[model samples]
Target: MKTTITPRVRTLVLLFLAVVGMLFAGAGTASAHAALTGSDPSSGVVVNKAPTQVSLTFSEKVATNNDSLRVLDPKGKRVDVGKPSNISGTTYATQIRSGLPDGTYTVAWQVVSADSHPVGGAFTFSIGSPSKTTVSAAAEQDVGGGLVGGLYGFGRYMSYAGFIVMVGGAAFVLACWQRGAGVRALQRLVVSGWVSLTAATLWLLLLRGSYTTSGKFGDIFDLNLLGQVLQTKTGASLVSRLLLLAAAALFIAVLFGAYDKREDEEKRDLTFGLAIGGGVVAAGLAASWALSEHASTGLQPGIAMPVDVVHLLAVAAWLGGLTALLVSLYRAPADNPVGRATVQRFSRLAFGSVVALVATGIYQSWRQLGSWSAFTDTGYGQLLLVKIGLVALLVGIASISRRWTGRLADSDTDTAKAETVVEETAAAEEHEPEKEHVTASAKTGGSSAASGDPKRAAQLARQQVAVDTTRQKRLRDADPNLFGLRRSVLAEAAVAVVVLAVTTALTTTEPGRTEEDAKAAKASSSSSSSSSSGALTLDMSFDTGGKDGKGIIRVDIDPARVGGNEMHVYVQRPNGRAFDVPEVKVAFTLAAKKIGPLPVTPDRITTGHWAANGIQIPMAGDWKISVTVRTSDIDQTTVDKNAQIG
Candidate 1:
């Protein structure tokens, strides 16, 4: 028999297609996580004179506290004269004192993205000539590390898991599996989800305090630190989530009768009110996550934040419902009518949720990754691809469950039709016999024992045939499709857990835009280094063991422009004695440009002296020059020096 598509099913299918079409139609330009895009005086650049101020530009508006931006001289002394000023929406600048010395300076900066996440980095620029100082880049402030960091990540994961369980479980009870509403196992799942979310939120608050303060485990309970964090937007978001959880607890208690021994069927009005109120609270809770995450900072916050909330809810509903379905399948009888009905209902609900999830995910991907290249080039984009692949697999598994549901529906239809046939046959046999008896009475003018014998026998035979047919239908081999569906749903739920973990990790990664910008800056700096005029000189020291353990190796690159150049090196002992080595060689590499370590075999001009002409400098940047000397077969040592091409 052909299956008829009900009007309700058609409506749902239309809605699903419409939403999907709208998502594809509204696809827009991509964006990325907030990151530094450009800066004044540019990193690794050589300026003719000291800049009076340094400016940093980010891809999005950011927030910062005092000391968020600083400039340090070659000697590691702070040179920035005052606190940074927000020159524009995404630009921050800090002034430096006039008449500064001509030396390399490092710019260190840390700021909070609009969404409340902290980002920081450091780079160097030179005034006049590059110096030989060993000042390292500014180190990032530790938010949390080791055990604390692990715990924080775990807490975040728990929060996500809890949301899916609580929201999804409650939705399943109200919509699909109403018969299982009062079951203790289902009730515990909801209660556990609620408790987990509340505890995770509170734990995160304390961890955030320690993260922003001293990055020490001991500071987790610091009252002052907690007070400071509570003043920030992140703190406010967490607090709001806690409040929503509290309200949800009340809704779950009253609506589901979680605390009562008996079902509260008399309070239908109260149940309805609690449901509507609970939905509002749940939405508010989702909004809290959006407010403190990448959605609020990266792209069009007005649109991205709301879409993120929807995306989160849809994921919870689908995955959470799957979890509930698995539990129901395990506990209920294989052929239970209620269990079968609940599975069919949940299948429909999950289909709708999946459509919504896909739509929102597409929009989010566009907002976060600006270009196609980012998909392979950036870590964030790579992780997103993995998530997409996993979701596709999950969808494939869900299709199997859907197929099984259809089979089950068909089986039910066949059984109902057989029962109807049996009922009709019995009704016909009763009425036919009565009519035959009336005819016989009229013909014989008196009651007869064998009245209408043939007709009665035919009627009885037809009734027996109907009874046999009904029994055959009832005895048909049981379908194993429901068992198969239960297994498929279980598989989907397992995969969903992995997806959630990946999502949590993605949130903490640097945005692709920042990584791309950093790569571009490095390439630009290398290109500029090759275009300068002047010879480059570098001093290196080597320990060759024995009496001549300490020796000085000096290199000279005449007119050290890119392409061919003459290179020379001199070696001397610490006491000004000529360090005579049997063989000496020089190797050069420009790592930033991925240039090779080209060996330059210089001729021994004199003792402790070497020279080579036609040495290729290649494209410049900071090149590492290594000088190797062999005093004996077993006593050889190499020393390295940085040769600034400019």
Candidate 2:
């Protein structure tokens, strides 16, 4: 005996494998929705004096709570003193304790992007000099803690899957196959969709707080955390979804119970009402996402939100309906096989959904990308390209399904005509006289007329058996058109699963426009900082042979140009505090011109500060600036840098 896999089992296997593959592919890296642009004292930069506050600038606006920002000193102690705030457009700041000890400190921040996704990261900056940080390496993990990120991603995927299934399944029953409501398989599909969405919404709401702030697993269950989540836009949208689901439940109940039981004529009247009511509920559900996610916060949000809702509804109707159709084909009762008209109607619906998807997708792509280069430059854009390719493949398969649908429709029409002709002839024969029946007995091959003669009746019995065998053979062989359509639809559905997964991943990725804007903002901030200081400063780290020789050297050349200039040098130990060294030396040479190696002797102004006035540079060119430091009589090292003197 051999075991064979059925179409239904194959479909399940495909879906399971696709889901597992998607999860495994993305497990190693989960991108953040908001990107950090710049930070004050900048990561790895050292300041002479401790600043009163630490500020960060992001690519987009972000929501903050009390614990959104934190600072840890060299000793891994909390040093921040106030709540983080939006001090300016896209810039947030938090005050730190005054007179912080000179050492490298870590800034850890987590906040909700305008799109309602949580993003967090950590970077280190020094007060007086770079130090060996004591903060745990985990502080720099930018994604929501690994487990939390994975769970959140799973919830997001489920929400999308649920919306498509529920909305699409209901739409198919209402628009394509009114009788589908009575199909148990379809009924389960729609109900499972609702349950999945409801559960996912609850999960996201519970986890939002922890995901945005601490990334701690234990924080997800803290009841107090719910309060904070509810205050945010994402929370509000989730609550709205639950309310809408209540309305959806009523819709589902009416569709499968009362509507299924109604007479065909009665259903016609109720369908108009149900369609209107269901459409509104579906749009509302779509709006719940549009109001909180990427569409609500991006450029032209007023337009984008409505477009996004349309996009989502189109996806549900197309992909979700494909799933429903596939199930009905494979699992509908043999007595009530899926009709050709139903498939044709869905073909029309899917076409319309595709039109809407394309229109809305173009607008969304423009809104998020802002430029052509972003298509290849950003993760969000790259993922979108992958989705586009998958959708194209799905559409190609749908075309094959449409052709098969057309053939099935034609076959059904011919079969119906032949059946009608057979019925009319049978009725005519029943009304004919006995003489007419006897006259036509040879051609009609009727058992009744031949029963009068033993030989004729025996001959008729054999002929009847042969005719019945032929009819059974035809019935045993499935319709080729229907089989082809089912196969094409299956392929479409399989591709749809992968497309949906990519779509879920897109939601968490930072848009290309946002990433570009962040880079621009960082450049502008750096330029402003450099202009304000009015000095060409070079910072370098050095280590001598001595036990405590690791430290940073800051060389500042005021109005660094050809001819006369003033130079200042400061040294600090790894703990970031100013420290004295055995000796320090500085010199410069214009390597391009083979100029002299000019030596500048600087007198010590303080323990770690030294200065040289009226230092001369003979020409403006790339000059090699070398600094040598001696920590002990035998422990000395030299470092070099090339700088423009003009």
Candidate 3:
């Protein structure tokens, strides 16, 4: 005889099949955003002579065109001879024209990272000496500001949400609860997931083009920009995601279509094939995201990438199945046997998914944050910690749901027992009259009791029926643990949404390892500072008026003891208020070495502040500095001060 399958045993089988399917399906490479690792003539460095070229090195290979790198002189003019060229795979270099004058020059660079995300920044370097030029390079603006960034993050969250709902919901319907196959709400959820992912991917592509090029909202639909974006890795990944979504939709339709009309045995074979196909598509879609995110560009990507795919699948399964289970609870009756079975099966599946999620999460954390301090020091690490905390909270809520599930099982058993007793009592009542009449005769005298027995038997039969009705009613009214379970599951799903949002933000953030490396580099450079690169600040007073004419002149020289120095002059009136002069110039003279009158014209910054760049201090000596302030072009006064240069 063929053995009948029990609900509990079937649940276990389905869980096993789901886990196996995910493991086999999630095997693909991952990618991440790039970071700058090092640069020649580091920011704020004082060099004895100007270098012929400027080079910027990144942690990954970069893609660039003509406008990728720019070098600006103290006067804010482009000094780079030509377009930047990629050197040795990772470095981008731009040549400087010969006869470049000594002064502070700013390098502004922008390039597409290996993952096809554009990254740019600006830094300054001094040649011969730092100048008081007020024309500093403009800082790169954040793409589209907070609103755009938030929209991008929202798109990512929606994509994640949709993936979980569609994939996990389909898996739940096929593997765990076939009854849900026809549920309109569950089917809608799957469709909604597909739509969300597709729409979000398209939206992100447009946003990314604008983001990378710093274009305005009007440029979002520009064909040239769109084509350029499509050529990039990120764009290709997004396109692949859409293709996978289409394939998934067809496969889901086939699976459901087969189930809607097939016999039980046929459904088994069809669902098995669907599972295999769906798993492949799911993994491919996940890989598309990983190929353009932090996992791909991060440390040990060979290991981290596949791990991320597993992590994503696990999350989708647990959270997505939770949503399906909640829907089942809402639509099905409180004592619905199918609903109870679904809850139980999903609970088991979720437990396994949580285990996978935790394991993969720990590994990813280790890969992203190599040291303990990074957890406290880096934004990425801190955000990860927040996500972990939320996951733990979700687990706690799930535990409550599990407890309620156990109670539901007990409730089901009691209800079943009561139902069985009702059936047996009803069957025995069919022959009750004869048995009752005989017992009545035995209790009294035979013929006298039989004459009145008919009326009494009818009355007793009515009373018996009343008692049975009451018993059945009480049993039916007992609670089935549905309300509590529904509430808990809802809470769990809410927190899961929050976790997804945080995860989306995490992908955009810089990894802790990169941040730590940058810090270490900064520290090393600062430690190598010497007297030639020392900074100094000085104060002097100029008598511009006859009697009470006392204007304070404050000079700030960065790397004051070196070949190149930046001079910032601040003038204040006799009443300690800022003094605005039309033209403020500084003339330097080295008397001991017989160097005389190196007049420097500084750009006027604001009313009381003046800056001069490329103030070349030829050698180490005592230099006399004269500050000339032209109050009205006619009314001018000079102040003298001495500075020791090394």
- Runs of candidate 2 with Cα error greater than 4 angstroms are 1-11, 24-29, 410-477, 521-646
RMSD values for the candidates in order, in angstroms, are 20.5, 15.4, 19.1
> For model 3, where is the 10-residue window of minimal lDDT?
23-32
* TM-score quality measure for candidate 2: 0.72
Model 2 clash pairs are none
Stretches > 4 Å off in candidate 1: 1-32, 47-52, 96-102, 137-147, 212-214, 258-271, 331-338, 406-482, 511-646
What is the alpha-carbon RMSD of candidate 2 to the true structure? 15.4
Sort every candidate by TM-score, greatest first: 2, 3, 1
What are the lDDT scores of the predictions, listed in order? 0.70, 0.79, 0.71
Number of the top-ranking candidate, with lDDT as the measure: 2
lDDT of 2 by residue, 359-412 (tens): 999999988887677889888889899999999999999988988888875536
Backbone N/Cα/C clashes per model: 0, 0, 22
Question: Residues 419-487, candidate 3, lDDT per residue (tens digit)?
Answer: 675676556654688645544544454344368766665665565555544444433334456556766
Error of 3 at 375 (Å): 1.3
Using Cα atoms with residue i matched to residue i, what is each candidate's TM-score against the true structure?
0.62, 0.72, 0.66
> Candidate 3, residue 158: CA error in Å?
1.4
